[model samples]
Target: MPYEGPRVYRRDELTYNRYLKVEELLQLQQPQSDPAHHDEMLFIIIHQAYELWFKQIIHEMESCIRAMMAHKALPAYRRLTRIIKIMQLLVNQIHILETMAPIDFLQFREKLNPASGFQSIQFREVEFLAGLGNEKLMGVFLNWPEYRDTLQRRLDGPTLRSAYYDLMRAYKYRIPEKISREPDEKEREQILDALRELYQHPNHKLPVYFLSEALIEFDEYLVLWRQHHVLVVERVIGGRKGTGGSSGVKYLESTTSKRCFPLLWEARTYLTKEPQWEAEENEVSDL
Candidate 1:
């Protein structure tokens, strides 16, 4: 096989706007505010930006999952790195939302009732693809047929964690047989024990060790994004119930500690934090 360069054409052949559909994209923001409040445009654009990023994140995650299922660590690592970078962008993006004053948010907040971020289908898909799905969460979308159907597909689908364990098994790691949407303490302990060995004796199993840290970084950034989201919501809406009729900040507060990879996180606690240096070994943290 030969390497191919990007396709090129005459100067008038293809354009930036045509390639990106910029005009169509610009028209998609249809704010319902009758008077067109000043801050509503910002709100719409920010959310639209988020949805675009969410779509890309899903694209990257699906590729990563496929690679993991095929026991391809290098490709999985590449996608995981992209996901981590995108998630960091998401975490920082919350600050833009926080910049809107409560008064400005209230000017257009009423227009958003029943259309909360909770209804973000892609975000829910992200959660499911990342190994965080359950019937209770799926039930939240049951009232809407389209949303429920989408969620139902994810509920019945494969998850990143499941694929990861399969990858570990392919690599000859002694991972536990039991896998669940919500793993029990015993099941978690079994997985954690495997992780402990990987962390302690990482030199020989370099690829598995790389994947483990990638997963941990992914989980860590997810937690950060959720925490940042909670703070942004609290800043904008205070103690008010969510426009979607949920407990708002309180609900978000409760979910901040949710880990998509619980065993990977718990495994960290058992690690000997003291420096273990090998001059020839590159720092996995750099990945």
Candidate 2:
């Protein structure tokens, strides 16, 4: 039965090209510029690659949320690590776009009117899933019903921040029932007190401690990406209005101050070793 002269393969066989749909992917880069400016191809490919990575990051973030809900700190932390690595890659990828000279970008920039990177639904999903949902942004997707619906679901769903606080509550931490971007002074104090206790006595809850640190790292890199992106945009366009009719660099600059987990950053202000106290020997279940 082992007598094969020449093995035959089917057209739909699982080869690398078929599995990845490489040919179809290559065909998607149709430049909008008349006669096809050379730099337009670069611009299209870079943004497409960004969408692909955003998809992956969203996948990982959803998994991280599930892990946190299950009270599995290690699994959540692992997913967050992957997300952080992908974000680092994205930060460097922006530099590659910077290689396209300002003059080169101008050649095809007009063709991109009303088609701004600001309309990236997946990026909005990432922000919403991170607990930074803004109802005002719903207007951006008004013309795209499908994308707007998707964003509506994300807005209604639980976020990574909510899941983290729920996990802390499950572990007997005194987390508030509600935490928002702008909490009252007493609410802020309560949240910071809980975080200070964790940082000061991490031995009591090492998994929570490590996972909290990972969340902060994720927040830090997100801000770093925004900062880098603003600098690159300023270098390229220099106060020019965006293709989507926004304030361009000024709008992006404002976003750099947004934090996915503001309490984590605020917690840093309260950390100190002077009044050291030992952690209690209470066991944290389901960690």
Candidate 1 has an lDDT of: 0.84
Candidate 1 lDDT by residue in tens digits, 1-287: 78798777777878888899899998998888988988888899988899999999989988999999999887898999999999899999879877789998898888888788887889989988888876677676676888888777877877788989988878777887767667778877778888887777676578778877998899899889889999889888899999889999999989888888888877878988544647425645312
Q: Each prediction's Cα RMSD?
A: 5.4, 3.5
Q: lDDT of each prediction vs. the true structure?
A: 0.84, 0.88
Off by over 4 Å in 1: 1-12, 272-287
Task: Point out where model 2 deviates above 4 Å.
Answer: 1-12, 275-287
TM-score of 2: 0.91
Cα error of candidate 2 at position 54, Å:
0.5
- Residue-wise lDDT of candidate 2 within 1-287, one digit each (tens)? 98769667787678878889899999999999989998898899989999999999999999999999998899999999999999999988888878889999888988889799899999999999998888888898888899988888988888898899888887788888887656788877887888888877776788899899999988988899899899999989999999989899999999999998888888878788654445444545234
> Per model, how many backbone clashes are there?
0, 0
